[model samples]
Target: MAITRRHLLQGGAVAAMAPALGLNTNVSAIGTAHAQSAPDGLKWRHGVSTFGDIKYPADFKRYDYVNPDAPKGGVVRMFELGTFDNFNLVVDGLKGSLADGVRLISETLTTRSLDEPSTAYGLLAEAAAYPDDFSYVIYRLRAAARWHDGKPVTSDDVIYSFEVMKKNSPMYSTYYQHIVKAEQVGDREIKFTFDGPGNRELPSIAGELPVLPKHWWEGNDPQGRKRDVTATTLEIPLGSGPYRVKEFVASRSVVLERVPDYWGKDVPVSVGKNNFEQIRYEFFRDDTVGREAFKGDQLDWFTERSGKQWSTAYDFPAVSDKRVIKEKFVNSSSGGMQGYAFNLRRPLFADVRLRRAFNFAYDWETSDRLLSNGEYHRDNSYFDGIAEFMATGLPEGAELKILESLRDKVPAELFTTPYKNPVGGNDDAARNNLREATRLLKEAGFETRDRKLVDAAGQPVSVEFLSQAQGDERSILFYKPYLERLGITVNIRTVDSVQYQNRLRSFDFDIVTTVWGQSLSPGNEQRDFFGSESADRPGSRNIPGIKNPAVDALIERIIFAKDRADLVASCKALDRVLLWNAYVVPQFAGGFQRAARWDRFSRPEPLPKYGVSGFPTLWWWDTAKAAKTGGRS
Candidate 1:
């Protein structure tokens, strides 16, 4: 079955973002029997896909959703939540924020089409070639590709960028973990060889590698300090993308000017995108001030992430006079889980019984009404509302067959029972939930002593809910008391964005509110999000610290499934196990993106299928509308 935006409208957390990436293959490691290669040479193509065929053929012009002739002018001013002190995006200890358009200044080997479900067209690489089993793949770089300094991008630069990323960033290292090596095969060809055959997402993951400039990072900074790839620095890096850092004021603002002579400006994937003449990002300390800035004309676009604000806050005169536009765009994203994640690393939440108790104690119904104006729905599964991938009803058929293989290891009820969230909104239901929670805690070897839930060692069951913004705890405040009824101590920790990232990377909190963004085509990134290996790695998306061996096997199954049928079955099986285990107290997600923007810009008639909204990317300035309402004044 095809997943659509309508299904995602009911997704938990990923209802608002673009999501993908991969992990260790579970299929038996490459062995002698699978050592076959192509007869003559690899076949070259303009794009690549995992389960489906490439949507656009080799000779297609621009993507169907973009306007090839969309005029580009005017500035798009936006806001970033916190401060930035580093220009290095993939480095560790990158405590400060990086410029928003940093990636715009650099080009990836392949660029994805927003309208398609699973596709990535060649960007810097004119063509991609691979053998039958996908053991090795080669990219033919376009000779026309040049750096911001007019230097040709060479094979050495690609090799150097891959080597540095694998060495410096844990994410890139894991994402590209299966790629055994990268070697220059031809004058313009870069080949990435994998450890084995049959893992399909490897080629695309390699294609997503951001090709960095070897010369600039290897050179000295303006202050004459030796450049270090592992360390954070303020040196403006050179790029070959649509935008260049025009200027910047540290921790305050950044302005990027469009590159008139960008090497890939006319590339099929680049058409009608990055249309803004200039992109400005102003840093703000609070969401309230930032929203006010949009109303005050200090900013041009503001996407409302808060449901409360979306319901009652956009009643300003600008909206009344039609100077500001308030609308919701239905997204086609294959969403992932967002919820109060239990740090399974914490001793208090180690037991599945205790985790179930915590879930039972959460009053999502009352909290949704109080905090989100009842415009949200609680998440029921890790991959909730994600088309056919989500595990629902009772597991059967191929999903059951897969689960049968690990019957002894997984939860026995997973084979027979459907996962459901605890229900509670009023006092009577709340009391029933409390009683069930108490029963579950007792079964988990915890007891109520002095009205406090304690372990065998008499240590109180305490949880700290970590959030980047204090205002985000509106729902948490309602959840806190219910847990308290079960004699569980709850603490809500509010930290700045930078600090929150640091703490999350270190796995320093007991419980954190986080989301694992998903895409329609789920692949290797699932490993990073839930694989046992990622549980221990710092900076990984496995915030709940899952380390189940069954999960590791399931992830490999999802990554190596031969076709769409196999992929869907494996994913459904994985979702069931995760949901039954209860690693998170699933939160609510909005059906559509409640966005507020100035009336000065216009988007293409049809927006991209698998995205939140093509803002400041596919949307361009309307000169007539801008004249009536000042744009980026």
Candidate 2:
């Protein structure tokens, strides 16, 4: 559940869309559906769901997970790993590094509930209406919704925001590709029309659109220069959300002060969130330095990623004295694939056998033991940890039927074999795996010449493991020797975060360790992750350049699925195909979130089922605890 640049830039605007069958069904008996008739024969509801009924009703006081009485007045100092150069989300992937926490300044049409798997409650929009076909969705803005400058948020603002995001951001462009047009259908309502019907998730996807102030962007900046939404700028942009940029020193640090007169403060969805009076983010070169800063009280909270550090590095006086709290929060979410993703764009990785050989060469057992202190689980599926979506013990039932239909497009091995990672805990297992890797390499037109792997064109098979974190280098260096034994020249190239993102944007690496975090409900976003169209896009998340027709077909199945059963079956089928193809050398997954923080905050008991640590969202500053721990109050 580590938030990456992709997750931060995308924001929470892409909530799960409901299936096609549930569109027109009246849910008045279910308490909170709030279904009403629209002029276009569509049904307007208070919320949207993917495959089930919405959790909260129209008159619900607040989310069940939050404490309405929780006091919220303290400064929370957090840390970001790299520098940021852009505050413009519209140009996020195309132009510069997006500043962390910028998403807090804007509000999405519908805000997803942390307790629900795939349901979103109205935030900016009071209600959303869509036809049974789901060809288009119309959102009615809240009368209370206003910009920071006190202007009413109109349909024109929503239309302009969607148009600018789709045109300027490659990520958004791909994410919203199915939506063909957006227009003002009412004074307070904006309609997003799709290319065709039957896409259940379109309504929620459209509802997730982040509304920006149209007049502010069209007007001039304080310096009298016309602002360009497509370009990056340091000038603090206009916002309507709970927080605004209070101060900053470029990339080094940023402070966001809570808007005391925020328009949405009294809204039900905003009742128990945005607790911090002043939220500050201090940027560091990497996590290692950030950990030391946390120990010195430079930051108030830290989420530890390295298992080894979580085990041994927090033996400081503050921790032993109970001034610092270290705990693990259960993560009941999809443990999506995180691995050394092979760049298929490279000619060296074009052959499936070669990619399979690399997987065999990765001694994950020994690497886990050394690097993580045996605190990680080997990832075997694209949808690991989600048993319903994970393909196991060979495909069967609906999953088998789905794969059988794609037999001509997918690998034959997918039907007969159950995908699993290579095991290598002992020397015997290590040698056996290495021998298999060598055999696969030979079959893929590679041969050992003078203690080096050479291809048919007499070129050595050299791969640079591009990385940005020192922790990643530790694992890469450990796996480098095993590949070297196969006569492969492995190079570990560690770069700064800015350079690393640039390389990824341009596809300028042989292999890189990246993560694809999955939600319980997977839909249109899958296209950006693995579809053929995103393979060539400059800033799309299809980082490995996957262009399989079978993968594309499976993604459509998941998007247009009719029910929970169909979605699960389609995801399992897609998982099996991706695993058999070996697009990435499988890595490890942590079942819980490891976090350390100063003991100055308190949260409601029984946290939300999905949000691992509510942190600044559900937790509030405790004056007595802050005094005891010497934390900011």
Candidate 3:
């Protein structure tokens, strides 16, 4: 059955109606596979589903529906990988994602809605105005907003955030490339003028800009700040967000305490949220102990690794009776691409036929069954929606130009007239592709001898799949059988997350599987992931080392797209080109989020557009009802 955005939005309503309507939507047993069923519930214990998270019972579960009219006081414990680094809030660092996630803890702006296309709305900025030239955008902050320490936030903070981040962080250059200058109009207003031709990406700016406290950072030039990082311990700066960092344990843990005087305490967006009286983020070495701790009620949430344990391991009668309510939030199909990335720098993989042969030999369905327990979906296109952009049809306008350009760069056989839109990966089709690959191998000075793929120098063709040690079991399992069939031995090497990151930074892998989630704006950064410049550079996300001029041009077209429709069409064309080249054997796209949480919280009649959890950051706890039910442990 085709899954739609409407179907995803109706998820909770459909789930609620199931029992009353006598429908058992037991997706537990997906397809022909039998999955373990949950027993009748006692009380659902609140928990998070994360890999290797520290276990703590103090995490609170606040529902969206039950607005507990209670005083604002509770610490929200979140699991952190490590200490707060200055580079996180900076735009130039590889660790910007986590920094962005952490910035929500201690910042505020004028607007309440972060989903708006204009960065004009947020807790700190009320409205943003853009000039006709797209040179800059001005943000007006609400005058009444105050930092947690009772200091008023002004334009200085905005400038400081941009300047400091641009000077120190690695990613700042990528996102803040259009900035011309930032001017403070008043204590409550700031104007950011852009210097380039680009649409106003408000959501990305709002999410990316972490409002820094100007008072604390005074006289700290961005250049000076970068050099003044000699101190081993730095005090947590004050901001007007809901949570504040209370303590840091270097490598093991970090704890955040709820701010009693949070500015938006009464706002509906924040009310009855950040429920836990104290949030203790404990870091562990591995998933085995994390699961054990969760089973023993020592942890509140475990994001990943719940699949295998929840299905096969955690079936103890005592644990099963609690009736763990599963929640699945589906949004528009991900803008990010997930697949087996090829190293285009490698000669054998450069040939489209060879790449397609590997993709054809691999049975994604079987691999998914073995790896994800049949709880997955195949990726049809890089853009996974049926929106006009994802809609299947002829590529026109700029898309046509892109396709035409890539025609020769990609294999002629793959994009021939009979199969302009050929669905890749079939056994017979794979054998045909293999035969073609063998021919290409010969052309590239390699020949198959006795079914073995080898170079003219008699060196065996092999590729190593490198991934983060603990989190990449699915990728490892999926490609193992396929590579073997092509007589190309694939070596799967699991390394520590830190090591894996280091290797990616150094471009030291033949093949790798990485999860790429799309930003809300979904702009130029999308193309940069696979662009030639990115492929050759250190610390770039383009691990494939692809350098084709046609691919680069297509990526550029996708970025200059004027609207969502144009963007989608351009992206589809680029996706087709990539697929034809067999640059990456597309893996299963993200399906439903397999998560279990205690039933302490409920949503109002109309959940927000993104569903129960407000866009990633704005989750709260209904303390009054939670207390009545049984307050924080």
Instruction: Name the best candidate (by TM-score).
Output: 2
Candidate 1 TM-score, C-alpha based: 0.93
lDDT of 3 at 355: 67
Expressed as tens digits, the lDDT of each residue in 1-633 for candidate 2 is: 112224221211222211223332232112234556664966668877665666787888799889888886999999777788888888876667778878889888988777766677889998888777778888889999989989998888999999998887877787798998999888788889999988887887787777888999999999999998888898899989999998989879989999989999878888988888989989886788999999999999998888899999999999999999999987774457788899999899999999999999888888888888998999988877676778898889999999999999999988887788899988999999999999999998999999999999989989999987775688888899999999999999987676777888899999988677776668888888899999988878888999999999999999888767888899999999999999999988877778899999989788887676877778988999999997766
Clashing pairs in 1: 21-525, 22-524, 22-525, 84-97
The ten-residue window of minimal lDDT in model 2 covers: 9-18
For each candidate, give its TM-score against the true structure. 0.93, 0.95, 0.75
Query: What C-alpha lDDT, on a 0 to 100 scale, does residue 614 get in candidate 1?
Result: 74
Better of 2 and 3 by lDDT: 2
Per-residue CA lDDT of candidate 1, range 361-390, in tens? 888898877777898888876665566678
Clashes of each: 4, 1, 46
lDDT of 3 by residue, 1-633 (tens): 001011111011001000011223221111111122211211111111101121223222333433455433443333333223332344222431132124446554432222211111235654444433344555557576788768887788788777775555434444455565677865565766665655434322433466777776553544466323222223455667777767756445656676777777654445555555456666554566655665554554444433444466566543455533445555433334467787777676766666656665566665555666766667666554333334244455766665776676754643443222223345676466556545655666766667667876798888888865344555576567656756677788876544555576667788887544443234555434667766766555566776778777766665555555455557667666665666677776554454454333444434433332432233444455445434363
